[model samples]
Target: MSRTTVLPVTRRATIVGAAVVLAVVALSGCAGTSGSAPEARQSPSKSQSSQSSQSSSPSSAERTPAPTKTTDAAAAATDLTFEDGAALSASTLPAFGLEVSALDGWEQTGEDSSVGSREYTKSDGSVATITQQRITDLDPSMGDRAATEQLFTAAGMPAEQLEEQLLPTMTGGTAQFLSIAGHTTDGSWSATVARAFAKPGAALIVKVQTPSQETLRPDLHDILVHAQVVLT
Candidate 1:
């Protein structure tokens, strides 16, 4: 049987293992969660749409014009493919987003429909999963930008200085911050965050079977550097 070992992540690990976790997390969506709920979903519901329309639609007195379709942060993160034997996939989660990228030769496999997680291959020939969810789950107080900052701080990312330098470039959404990994600040053990992303909130997450700070960080940096908003 194909067993997907989706593991969770920690802030401290993100600092030292930034490069490894970044890459692996994307492909595997092994970025952990706090609850039993599934990861983020790509699509919206009819009720949600109707409610949105009603809220956004202008009233007779306030009707200046039709509300132009505006895009959010999640719309900004794009899914891409590369020639460097890296495979990347992205899905929107309302105000948030989820992305994954991996090297070539990693076999693809199907997984159980629970949480809508898809399975993939780990570097050690193990299986992993990808998930989606809201920023709240990652860290309730901080939004996506802040959560990402925490991850970078924990990962000991050198790019952190760049964050202050590129403050204008980063986004702050109500549900964009992502909580990755399922272990403590220390790197001895690993757990998995399931049913991540609270719908009507953020979504899109990756899971990993193992935690490799070396293998995951660089790819994550590359993805964030190259990521752009996809409105469609």
Candidate 2:
């Protein structure tokens, strides 16, 4: 079986009050193409940055072309595999009514009000999402609850067998935190952590899904916590 992959994410805040659960489905939440390195590209970190880039190049067959010298034109760099470590670009999401200043080299999309999500990416590559949807009622399924069920079902687990905890957020509020750790159907080790919060009218959520890393959970939680609520 193919290795379980945590597809990149880029979303906005959107949810209502619903029961929270723990589960993981396919990484289809954000809905978009992921960033891929350009074909036959070299990493600056490994390249000498100077003259002959021999050691950094691929084998002769993979690097060279026919020896015929013909008048050919040059084309612009097609593969965007090279990353220069640029800073994240700041952006404002009018739908979610928030601004993101921490993003470095990330861009935004999904501006339609109905979607109301601000998706971010770096160098045209997806990293994470701040998906937002207008919340009008109390539906736990809209936040962590919904995320847990969907993800758990996707991975085919006992959705009812997970644990839920009250988590603190940077927004000066509390969120229901839920997580699941087990082997995927393919038998690869996996884990998921999701946090959900609510205010006067919005149901907020932040989910960082990948193989088995616990580093970004708190950071994603705080991001939603501190999001300046401008919804009306």
Candidate 3:
């Protein structure tokens, strides 16, 4: 297994949103191409001033390679391996929509059960996604909920800020605060897993310009609801 640590790359706020900027680091682990260095390829942090003459265009200069249709050899080489919702079993899920794929240039690392990162290409290859998975041995319970809450509370900021930035950009479907039967938030679009049967669970989040209301709600709902403890 490849042990890859993604360091988020800060970028110009004028060109990219905070979500997209942070996403550059988060996704690098998931979508790196063959032999690409996830960290090496990243541009300087957003706080660092770049030469004004440097390529100011985000699309041309800061873009990562998009995941296109892979060849048989390429697809076989990609490291996407899931066993019928191994991370989050489909059986334990509520009705929702979801889409996933095995992508190339992804590598496994020494992170508990397994840890892998890869990128997804969508929107005619204009948009890219990086995904990371880490299997662990911690189950949710009354006693552990406190610790879990703490983790979520810390991680939730970026998620919420990203969602808030995205909401306005989102059009079409109704945008409402997600109030699950057993969970709550301080009003944000990011999904935080509230409970699960399995010890360590899986989580998948996509950073794209807010999609249509209908598409955004169902896509996120499915991913969140299906998030369960499956990997042993």
Candidate 2: C-alpha lDDT: 0.32
lDDT for each residue of candidate 3 in 68-117, tens digit (9 for 90 to 100): 54222211211111111123232221111212312232222212212222
Clashes of 2: 31
In model 3, what lDDT does residue 52 have?
A: 21
lDDT order, best first, reads 2, 1, 3
Evaluate all candidate structures by whole-model CA lDDT and list the values in order: 0.31, 0.32, 0.23
Highest lDDT model number: 2
Give all TM-scores, in the order shown: 0.32, 0.33, 0.26
Please provide, for model 2 over 69-169, each residue's C-alpha lDDT reduced to its tens digit, 9 standing for 90 to 100.
31111011111111200110112111222335433344554443454444443442223444444334434324335544544444454666554433322
Residues 78-176 of candidate 1 have per-residue lDDT tens digits of 321111001112233221122333223355576544343456564554444444323334443333344444544545432323111110011221122
What lDDT does candidate 3 reach at residue 2? 27
lDDT of 2 at 80: 11
Question: lDDT: which is higher, 2 or 3?
Answer: 2
